[model samples]
Target: MALARGFADPVHDAQAVFRTVMDALARPGLVRRLACGLAPPAPLTPELAALALTLADADTPIWLDPSLAGCAAVSAFLRFHAGAPIVANPAEAAFALIADPGACPPFAAFAQGTPAYPDTSATLILALARLSEGRGLGFAGPGIRGRAQLDAAPLPPDWPERLQANHAAFPRGVDLVLTAPGRVAGLPRSAQALVPEEA
Candidate 1:
């Protein structure tokens, strides 16, 4: 099978994507656009593919959700572009790409860093259909002033509950980076996802 093309300018594109990702993580619910123009394999959206290319490296172990894992093209793309090793064990993954959020396990299922080394925990990159503003989960935490709203749908009904658990775990929990067609958002473990009643 022919491999797809990655970033047009590898260095600058990766740096651009990395900066956008960091900005999103710094301000929960904030969305940033990416224009790397990468055409990775199926089930790998440009946004997620950009993330993989920007963040994953030979030293980072990646875990793909069932859908992404079963797609040979997707694996090949990651290997060729990201140069990251694919790991079957979620607990061992430095980054976990989730193409099917509904079937994704709870946050606790992945690696939670030790209290002494919180930064070692896994970061989850979720591929969503889209992200909308002003009407989803309420967010508040370090980056947020008072509260912020984000709507990334097609997620499991218990997403808020799961997020609450993730937030409560604090420095030890996995952080989330959500991706749509050309945009991305972050939900760091420090950010709180308020349930409906609390919103």
Candidate 2:
């Protein structure tokens, strides 16, 4: 099978994507558009491919969830374009691509970094079925002014509880970037999920 092409302008496109990623993280629970110019293989979405191209490198090891790992084309595409090492161990990865959000592992399953070097934690890039509409979850913390809401699904039903614990871990936790088609959103470790009664 023929592989899809990467960004038309690597320098500019990557910069745009980087900004989008940053903005999403900066404004937790806010959605942003990723005008990624790639059409990667099945299971590997444009947003995920764009992220892999923009963030992954030779030094960064990436872990793909079973859904994505089983796709040979997705592996080949990332290997060819990102030139990043694919690791079998999630704890050893600097980044992880999750194509099946419902089946994705808990935050504790991946690297949660150390108190001294919290930046070493793994970042999960989750592909969601609908980021624009779902059962809304409220968030509050650092990046958010008061509180913010997001509706990305089908995430694990325990996500709110999981995220709360992830936040309580403070400087040692995993961050999440959610994507759907051309849309992207962030749920950084600093963002704390609110219970329904509070939302």
Candidate 3:
């Protein structure tokens, strides 16, 4: 079996990916391309790989969905490159990687930090097929001036409702990183996902 490839230039590559993640989070609903070269195991894209490299570290515990968890190559790559420990329990994880957001566990299943320490909440990294092109949902909140439209298809049908409930928790909700082939988007706890009104 071949070992998965990590960043060609660790420091520089991680910094670049981190910048893109920060921009996406600061400008919720915006789609950004991650320009990195990584060949992680199956179901892991360049964007997702960059995200895992940028976010996970020695102190952070990560949980992978069944498929990814079963892949020894993926586990070894993450462990060696990011120095992140893999945990079995989702609630104990600071980060959770889900290959199929449509089949992901409910929002409440992951850690939702307490009001006093909301920063401890889990961050979910989701691998999506492709972001919706035409219609999806409207986003409103902090980063968004008025509103931003996002086409997030293949997500569970009740995602909007689930997100609404999650947002109601204020500072105590999980954050999401949605990644495609080379593109990524952030959906912070503060962002509201709403169904677009009929035209």
By TM-score, the best candidate is 1
> For candidate 1, lDDT tens digit of each residue in 1-199?
9999989999999999999999999999988886779878888888889999999999999999999999999999999988999999999999999988878788887999988999899999998887876888899999998999998977998898999998898878999999888888999999998886744
Model 3 scores worst on lDDT over the 10 consecutive residues at 129-138
Worst 10 residues of 2 by lDDT: 129-138
Model 1 clash pairs are none
Ten contiguous residues with the weakest lDDT in model 1: 190-199
What TM-score should be assigned to candidate 3? Answer: 0.94
Tell how far residue 170 is off in model 3, in angstroms: 0.8
Q: Which lDDT values do the candidates have, in the order given?
A: 0.90, 0.91, 0.85
TM-score of each: 0.97, 0.95, 0.94
- Compared with the true structure, what per-residue lDDT tens digits does model 3 show for residues 23-89? 9889888888878888788766667678888899999999998878888888888898889999999
| Model 2 spans with C-alpha error above 4 angstroms | 133-135, 197-199
Backbone clash numbers for all candidates listed:
0, 0, 0
